[model samples]
Target chain A: MEESSLLPPVVLVHRPPALDFIDEHLSRHSFTALYTHTSLEDSLQDFLSSHAASVRAVVSLGRLPIPAEFISNLPSLEIVVCASVGFDHVDLDECRRRGVVITNAGDAYGEDVADLAVGLLISVIRRIAAVDRYVRSGQWTRLWDYPLGFKLNRKKVGIVGLGSIGSLVAKRLEPFGCIISYNSRNPKPDVPYAYYSNILSLAADNDFLILCCSLTDETHHIVNREVMETLGKNGVIINIGRGGLIDEKEMVKCLVNGVIWGVGLDVFENEPEVPEELFGLENVVLSPHAAGMTAESLNNISEVAIANLKAFFADQPLMFTVQLD
Target chain B: MEESSLLPPVVLVHRPPALDFIDEHLSRHSFTALYTHTSLEDSLQDFLSSHAASVRAVVSLGRLPIPAEFISNLPSLEIVVCASVGFDHVDLDECRRRGVVITNAGDAYGEDVADLAVGLLISVIRRIAAVDRYVRSGQWTRLWDYPLGFKLNRKKVGIVGLGSIGSLVAKRLEPFGCIISYNSRNPKPDVPYAYYSNILSLAADNDFLILCCSLTDETHHIVNREVMETLGKNGVIINIGRGGLIDEKEMVKCLVNGVIWGVGLDVFENEPEVPEELFGLENVVLSPHAAGMTAESLNNISEVAIANLKAFFADQPLMFTVQLD
Candidate 1:
C-alpha cells in the first residue's frame, strides 16, 4: 500500500467512454491506462500475454463476462472493479480466493430508477397510456364510454426492500398523498413510514407492492405463488429491482387468472426474451430493463464508477466493495 | 336591499343529490320552492301563463338552455342563477336588459380540473402512452433506445389568465419544481408567480404554456397564430380551458409545421367530434373535453350548482355571480 507501489497499469474492456472519466482522473497519478474494446476471448488473451507485466488492475463494465480462467491468468491483477451495481457476471469466488479487491457501482442510479418506478406506478394507476392510445387511434369518438381509472391518492404503497431505490421511491410518492410502508432486513428510524414485520403481511395490506430488493440466493423467486396469493386480486405489483426475485411463471399464471389486478415490470428472468404470453394483456405494463437508463443516471453511474476506480488505484479504502464472505 | 325584498320564491330545476345537500341546509326557509323538471318548452309556457305569479327567481343547472324569449316573457323573474361556470349557453344580454340578476358556479371545479391538467401534462411530456402501448403490444424485449422525454423539473410554466383553474394548476405544478409565470386581467399580489403583462411574452419565455383563461369576447382565440409562433418550436401547449380560446386551424398548422413540440388538448373546438387531421399526428395528445369530468369534479359541480339554488331561496348571497355591465 506504499505510495510508490500504488501506480500501476490498468486495462478497460468497454467502449465509448466507458470509464473514460475514471481514466482521466487516475492519469494524474502516473498510472498508465490501456483502453481496448475487445470481446471476452480477445480481451482475455491480450491482458494475459501483452500487459501481464505492467497490469495491476482490471475494470469491467459488466458488458463482457469474465471467466475464472481469465481472472486466474492475470498474475499482476491486484484489484478488479465492475462498473455496475450487480456483479453476477463476475467470478467473485475466484477473485476472493486470489485475495483480489473487488468493488462495484452501487447506489449510483437509485434516484433515476426510483423516479421511473413512481412514474410507472402513476401511469398504470391512472391509465394514462390507455387514454393516450384511445385518443390517438381516433376510436375515441365512437366509444360510448371512457374507461374509469382511479387516482394514486389514498392508495397504500408497499416497498419490498427499504434500500436506496426503495427509499427514494417512497419519498417521491409522498407528495402524491400515498401512504407508504416498507419491509427491510431491519427497520430504519429515519424514514417516516410504516414497517411490516414480514413480507406476507406487507403484501396483504398494500394496494401496490414494489420489488426493490436485491436478487441474492436467499431472495430469488421470493414473489412466488404464495406471495401472489397473499397480494390478492386488488393488488398491483411493480418490479424495478432484479428480475429473478419474482417467479415469472407463477406471475404469468396469477396475471391471467386475475390473482393480481395489474403489473408493471422493468426486468424479467432470462431477459431480452420475455414470454410471448404477455403480449396484448391490458393489465400488464412492461419495460426493457431500462428503469435506470435515463441520461441523468448514465452520468451518475459514470461519475460513481470513476470514483471507485480512483480509490482502487490510490490503494485506499474502496467506496463500494461487494463483500463476498 | 330590504329583507322582504331579498326573499323570493325560487324555481329549482335539475334536482340531483347535490341540490338535496344544499336543501338540507335551507329547508327551514320561508320562500316557496317550485320543483319542475318539465321540458324547456313546457317550463317556458308554464312560467309565461301560470307559474309566473309565484316564480320570482329561476335557479337552473344549464341542462336546458334558456331562450331569450323565455327571459323576456317572465315578468316576475328577478334573478337567474345559471348554477355553473361558463355562462356561454345563457342569454346574458337578455337577462341584463330585463334587470334579472345572474350568477354562476364559478371556481367550483378549479382544483379537480387543475389536477387533471397537470396529469395530462406529465402524461404527454413523459410519453406515458407510447411506452404503455409498447409494453402492452409485446414489443418490449430490450431496453428502449429513445432519449428520455422532458421532465417537468426546472421548466418555466406559463399560465394564461391566472383565474381559479389556472391558479390551481400553478399550485400543483409548484411541487414539481417549475417556475410559474402567469398572464391575467390584472396581477394579484397574493400569488407567488411572476406576472407576464402579455400572452405573447409569456408564451415566448415558457417551456409549457397552459391555457386556463375563461372564454370571453375579449379572450376568445387569445392563443392564436401570433402567440403560438412566439411560443416557438421547443415549447408545449396544454389547453384545459375552453376550446375556442385556441385557433384550431392555427394550432393544427403549428403542430404540423413543428412550430411546437407537442400539445395536450382536453378541450377542442367543436368537441365530441375531433378533427380527423389530428389523429395521425404524434405531437398532439387529445381528450374528449373531459378535463372537468372526474368523479370528484362532477360531485363538486353538482354540489355547487345545488348550493346556488338553495341560497337563492334562503335569501343568502349566491356565489359566483356574472358581471353583466
Candidate 2:
C-alpha cells in the first residue's frame, strides 16, 4: 500500500533475455528484469527473493514456459498479461490454484494470423512457392510441362479450432469459395459453419485441415498418422497453431511417403530445426514460426497486453480473460 | 451444303502442335490441323489452299496471333472461339472488318486467375516465398531476426481492371478488411468499391496495385515507371494480366532501385525468359504464366469454348461474345 502510493505498479517480464518486447514496452510499470545470460539459477533465485514480493503482474512474451515452480516464486503475483494468443506456455492449474487472473492478446493477432493462414493455404494449394522455385531455377524454359496446381474454389477446409483466429480464417476463406467446417471442444452456437466434435472426423471429411487450436494436453499430437491417412493423398495441412498439435515425426513420414498432398507450416515441433527431408519437397511450404510476425499485429498485441495490465491494476474487468478450465 | 450433310461442320485448329486442348476436346466438329514442325509458311499455305474454304470457325489457342492473312485464308470464317480469357492476340480490327464474331473463354478462367492474383498478392505482401526460402535455406536458426511482413487487413488495394478477374480479386480481398478501388475504361455500377478513371491516381493512392486488364493498344505498358514511382516504397504490384500491361524493363529497374516495394508477376513481357535481374530479388514472386493453368479452370474454359462453338453452329446466342471495341 505504501509502495503503490509512491511508485508505479511492479511488473515482471517472463521471456528470454533477447525478447525485449516487455523491456521496450510496459514503460508505465516498473518491470523487473530477471533474465541473466549466465548463472541463471543463482541470480534468478537471488533476484526472485528480493523483488518477487513486489511484483504484482507478469508480462509473458515469446511463449516462455511459466511453470509451477516459477509461479511459486511469485507469491504476490495477481495477474499475467500474455502477449500472445496462445498462453499454453503458462501453467493454467497453478494460476487457477493461486487465484491469479490471466488475460491473453485476444483478437489482437486474429486478423494477421488468419491472413497468414489463408496465405499459406493458397501458397500450398496453388504451388506458389514451388512455382516460384521453378521459375527462379530457370526450369520453366526447359520444362514445357509446368506442374498444374489445385484450385482453392469449393475446396473443403476443416479448421482444427474455431477460436478467434480460426473464425477469421473461415471468414477470409469464404470469399475464396472454400467450404468451411470446424472442430472444437464445443460447438460454437452462433456460427453457421458445420462443427465436428472430433478432429479425426473433420480430417476425414475435408480436403484441407488447418490447425488453429491451442496446444493443450488434449490437442497435442491430435493430428496423427490415422487422421492424416483419413485426410488422404489430396489432403493439405496448414499449421498456424502450435507445432505440437501434430506429430512431427509421423508428418514427415506421411509427407515422404506421399500419404498427404502438401503442408504449409508456420510452426514446427522442434522450431528453428525443420526436418531436412522437407527442404527438397516441392509440395510443402515451410515458414519460420512467423504467422503473427507483422508490424501491425505486434503493435496490436503490445497495446492489448498493456491494456490488460492497466485494467488489472484499475480493478476493472480485464479484456481477453482466459477461462482456466 | 452437300458436304455439310455428309460430314461435321468444318473448324480450323490454330495453335502450336504441343497445345492439344482443341484437338483433344473439340470432337463434334471436323477440324483441320494446319501446324507443321518445319516449313510452317509453305505447308500452312498448302493446307489452307486445300482445306481452308470449308473451315467456318478458327479455334484460337495459346495466344497465337490470328492475323488478317490467316483470317482471309478462311473466307467462310463466321466465328473465332478463343480458348483463352485474353483474345488480344487475335486481330480485332480484322475481325470487325470481316464481321466475324469472336467468343472468348470468358468467366471460365476468372475464378482461378483471381485466386492466383490474390495468392500472388499475399505471397508478395507477406514475403511468403522469401520466408520459405529463408527457412528452407536454414537461415532462421542462425538469424533470429525473421523479416516482418505487411498485413493484408486494412490494406488499400487498387485493381487495374475491374472485369471478371479484377472483380473477383476485389471480392476475395473485402473480407480481409482491404479497402478496394479500381481503374478501368469505365466504372462498374454494381460494385461498391471506389473507381479511379486513370491508372496513375490508382497507383498513387493504393498500397497494392493488381493488374487484371487486357493487353490492348491503350492498355499497353499501363503500369510504367511513373505509375510505379507514384506507388512508392511501400507499394506492391501484382500482375495477373498480360505481361505487356507493365513495362518489364522499367519494372526490373524499379525493383532493383527500390522504386516500388515489390511485385508478384504471373506474366512477363517476354515470358519463359524472365528478366535475369528479377532472379536475385527477394520481394518479387514470379510464376511462369501459369495463373490460368489449373485443371478446373482449363476444364471450365474447354466447356465454355465448346459451348460457344455449339451455340454458333446452332445459330443461338454466344455465351461470351467479345465486343470488337
Candidate 3:
C-alpha cells in the first residue's frame, strides 16, 4: 500500500474480474490502479472525491454510460481507456469538452467478433439451432421430411458497415461464392464490392442484411420497417452491432408477420431482458450479448487496454484514439 | 397410357415424388420413364420380371441398398444413374461383375454441402444451439453466467479429405484465421494445405477435425476410438461425410465419457435413426441428412442424372463415371 501510494498518475477502474492486467505488467511500469466497487467498497463519488485531482486516467471496464455527472467528479481526468470495441455507452460530448483523450480495443477483437457474426448468419439461415432441437427431441426417427435450407452459395449479402468486422465477413463469405455489397457512411475507395448511398436499395437487392455499423445518433434505427419491407419475405437480418441500430419492435413484428424470413440477434435494445415474443419463434436465433466474449478476445482486450494506459503515462502516442464528437 | 407404352427402352424407378422431369424435358427427348412403385406398388422382382430385358436402365432415386440380387434381376440394365453424390448404398462390386455403368451426381451439390459443413462446425464450437434453447426457455431472465465459447482465430483445423467439399471448407475457413491440414488416401501434390498421410498425427495437432472424405472399404471407421482419444477432450469433430466413416457406437461412448469435446453430425450409419444417448447432450449439434438437399442442388442433381441417362442411350461419353471396385 505504501509503495503504491508513491506511484505516479493514479488510474481509476470500474472493478476487477470484469477486466485486469497480469499484475507484473502494471508493476513494471509503476502505476497505481485503483478499483472502484471491490465487494462492499466505497461508492464512486466517495472514492473519486477522496482521490480528487491525482486520478488523471480512468480505465473503463464495463458498458455503462459515463455521463456528465460522473465525469464532473473526476475533474483532472485526462484519458479514458475502454476495454471494448463499441463505446456508445461513453458520453462523447462531455469527454470532448474536458479534452479527455479516448482509446479502445481496436482490431483486437475484430477477428473473433467477425467469426461470431458469420456463425450467427449461417445458424439462422441454415436453421441449425431449430433442427438441432428437433433431432434432440427424437423427431428424426419419426420424420423423414426435414425442411431444406437455402444455400449460401451465390446468395447476395448486404453489409451495413465496411469497417474491420464487415470487411472480414466479406472476405470469409467470398469463398462460399456469396456476392458482397454494402452501404456505409461514405463509399470506400479500392473496395470491389458494390456500394449504395442509400440503405433501402441495398436491402432490395440482397437476400441478407448484416448490421455491423457503429451506433450513433445519426445511425439509430437505421434499419426500420420500411427498409425491412423492401428486403421482403425471403430476407434475413443479423445484428452483431448495437440493438439500437434496428427498430427492434418493428423488426419483431416483421418476423411475426413474415415480412422477413428470420433473424439472429446478439444484442437487444433492453438486454438481459429480450422481447418476450421472440422466445418462441423457431426462425430466430438469440444470444445474450456474447458475440465478443471469447476468452482469447478478452485476453487481447486486457493487453490492448494496458498498453494504452502505459503509453498515456509515458506521454507517448496511443495505440488507438476514438473520434470525439 | 397407350401412348406411354409405345415409347422405347423402359427405365425403372423406385417410386414417384423422388425424382422426375418437368414434362417438356422428357417429351423433347422422347423416352419412357416408368415409375415402379406408386400408391399400389409392385414388388421389385415382379416389376422387373414384367419389364423383362426391355428395362435398359435403372434411375436410383433413394438411398435404399441395391444388392447383387437386385442387379441380377435387371440383367438388361446397361447403366445406373444415381441422383446422389455418395454411392455407398449401391453395390459397386455387383455392378462391375455385371458390366453395368455407374454415374453419380458429380460436384453439383459440392458448394451447398460445403456450406453446411462450415455451419455445423461454427454452431457446435460457439454453442449456438444450446444457448438458443436457453434463451427460448426464459433462463436468460435469471442471474445466470452463460458459458463463453472458443474463438476460431488462429486455431488449427484438420480436414479428413481434400476433395471438392473439403477444399471448399478449407477455402472458407482461411479468412477466419484457421490453419488447414488434411488426411487423404494419397497426398495431393497441387493442394496448398499440409498433407497428413496418417490421421493420428492430424488429430494430435489440430483443435478441430472436419471429416469430409468418401466412404469405402479402405476408409470405413477411419475415425475410430484411437483417433478420438488422440483428438482429446478439447477437440471438436464435424462430420459432413457418410456416418459409417465414424464408428457411431464408439463415438457415442467417447462423447459420454468426455474423450472429445463436441460433435456436429449431418449423416448417420442408420438414416432417420440417431443414437438416443445423444438426445441429452448440450455439447452436440445434430442435423438430419440434409447437407446436400438444398433446392438449388436438387435441381442440379436432376439435370445431371438425366444427362447421364441420355448420354448412355446415345452412345456418347458419359458426363461422369464412378471408378468401380
Candidate 4:
C-alpha cells in the first residue's frame, strides 16, 4: 500500500484480489484505496465503521453482494461503483432509496462476451468441443468416422436483448449467412433485422435462440417449459446472460428428453453447481460463467472501473450510471 | 446393388460402407452404382477387368486412391467422378495422359469447411474445448476462476487461399472485427483484402495463418519450420485444407517448444493417425480430416458427384470439371 499522506481522500471497498494491475491506476488518482474486506487484521464491520464518515465512494468488484446493511453503515456513501457489467448481486433497490449513485463497467466486456457467445454457439453446432474430447480421450479411431454436426450457414438465429453485447452478436452472425431476427425489450426501428416482441414467437421461428438480456423479475426464468417446447426438438439455445434468464430445471428436462437439439451455456442458474446430467451429455457444451472474463477484456474492464472511480472522486458525472428507481 | 438391367449402363467403383444415404441419391438418378470393394469376393482387379470396356465412368468415393494401373486397365474410362473435393489420391497425371475427364464436388463442401475453419479457430483461441473438457470432467470449481483466453477482435488473420472456402473464412471473421489479409497463389485484384505473395511475410505479420489452399507440389509442406518460427510464440494456425499442406513434424516441434501458441487442425499429415504427442496437448485441438464432412455437405456433394456421372452418360457439359495439366 502507498503512503496515505501523498494520496487524496480515501475510497473504501473490496477489490478483486487478482487486480493488482489496477493498483497503479488507483494510486494515480491519488485516492487511498482502502479495502473493506481483505485486510488481515480488520473485520469488514470494524473497517467500515471506522471509515464510515470519510468514505464517500465505494468500489465493488465482480458480483460480490453489497448488503443494504453495509450501505446504511456508510452515511456519507454517495456512489457505488460496480466493477462488472451485470449488477444482479448488488442491491439496486436499497441503493436507490439510499440515493447512492451507481455506475457499471459499460461497453468494456461487450466484445469479449459477444465473441464467446458466437464461439460457444459455433462450438455446439459443429460439435467442436465434443469431438475435441473424443480425439483427446483416444475415442477417435483410425477408421471410425465422426458423426455429422449441423452447419451455421443460413440457420435462423433469434437474439434476446439487442443491447451492446446482443447487437454485436447479431452483427458477427451476419457474415456467416445466418438469418438474423431478435427479441429485445423494444423494437429497434432503425435496425435492419426483424424484431420479435414475444420471445415465444421468436423461439418458434428460429433455429437458435441466444440469451444476452439482463436478469430481472420480468426476465427471471424467462426461458420456461412453454418456450422450450416452442423451440422444438432440433432447436438450440445459447446463454451468455445471467443463469436466471432461463428456468434451468426446464432447460435440463428439455435437454434430457431431446426437447431441444443442444445448448451452449456459459452461465447457469446455480453456476459452479451445474447439473450433473449435463456433464454426460454430448450435445451440450458447458462453460464456467466466463464469457466476459478474457485476459484482454479483464484489462479493458479494469481500466473502465478505475476510470469511473477516478471520475467519481473528481466530482464529475459518472461514466456509466445505471438508472435505478 | 440395384439390378444392372434397369439403371444407366453402370456407375463403377467402391462406395463407403457407411454411405447408405448416397444409395437413395444414386437410385434417384437411376444409375447402377456397382461396388467393387464393398462386395465380399470380387477384387478391384477382377471386377474392373471383366467390366472395363462397358465402364465409361468410374465413381471414386471418399479418398480411395485410383492407381495408374487401374486407370490403364479401364481402357474405355472417359471420366472419373471424384466424390470428394481433394483429388490428391487420384493419379491425375495418368488421367490427363489417358484423355480421361475429371470432375469434383466443387463448391458443395465450401460452406461447411469454411464454417469448421472459423469454429476451430474460435475453439482454439477461446479455449472453448479445454474449458468444456474442464466442465465435463468436474474440474471447474466455484472459487477457482477459469483462466482468461485470447481475444480475436482486431487481430490480423492471413488466409493462405482466397478460393471459395478461404473467401468464406475471411467473410466470417470480418464481423468479429478481424483484419483480413491473404497469401493466395495469385494476387486476386478483385479482392479488397491485402495480399501477401510471400507466405513467410504473411505469417510474420499476422496473429493467425489459416490454411485453405490446395495440396499441390508447390503448396505441400509450404507451412514449414521457417514460417512457424516467423509466426512467433503467440501465433495460431487453423487448417481446414489438406493436412499435407503443413510440415506436420515441424508443427509438432513448434507446438512442443512454444514457438507457436496453438493449432486447431481438422486435417493431419498421416490422417487417422494423428501425432500421438498431440493427444496430450491442451493447446492443440484435433479433428480427423472431417472439415467438409458435415451431414448437409455430404448430401450436397453426393448430388454433385452423381450429377457429374449422369452428365457424362447424358453427353452434357461436365459440372465442376477439374482441369488436369
Q: What digit string (tens of lDDT, one per residue) describes model 1 on residues B4-112?
A: 4666555544332223333433345544666544434475466456665556777665234677876766677778766456676668889888888877767665654
Each candidate's DockQ score against the native complex? 0.21, 0.51, 0.51, 0.59
- For model 4, what is the error of residue A42's alpha carbon versus the real structure, in angstroms, after optimal superposition? 9.3
- Across B105-205, the per-residue lDDT of candidate 2 in tens digits comes to 87777788899999998899889999999888877762346677888888899998898788899999999999999999998898899999999999888
Would you estimate the TM-scores of all the predictions? Answer: 0.71, 0.86, 0.87, 0.91
lDDT of 2 at A64: 71
CAPRI class of candidate 3:
medium
Query: For all the models shown, what interface RMSD does each have?
Result: 5.6, 2.5, 3.1, 2.0
- Cα displacement (angstroms), candidate 2, residue B315, comes to 5.9
Q: Kindly list the per-residue Cα lDDT of model 3 for residues B1-325, writing each as its tens digit.
A: 4553455667766533533432234456656776665523557678767775677787776565677877888768888888777676688899998899988888888888888889898888888888888888777742335666789988999999999899999999998889999999899988889998989999999999999998889779999999999999989999999898899999999999999999999989887889999999988999988788776777677777778777777788897689886
TM-score, candidate 1, is: 0.71
Best DockQ among the predictions, by candidate number: 4
lDDT tens digits, residues A191-289, model 2?
999999999899989999999998989999999999999999999999999899999999999999999999999999987789999998999999888
Docking quality level of the chain pair in candidate 1: incorrect
- TM-score leader: 4
Q: What are the C-alpha RMSDs, in order, of all predicted structures? A: 7.1, 4.0, 4.0, 3.4
Write model 3 residue lDDT over A246-297, tens digit each, in one string.
Answer: 9999999999999999999988888777888999898899987778877778
Give me the displacement of residue A273 in model 1, in angstroms: 3.5
Q: Is candidate 1 or candidate 2 better by TM-score?
A: 2
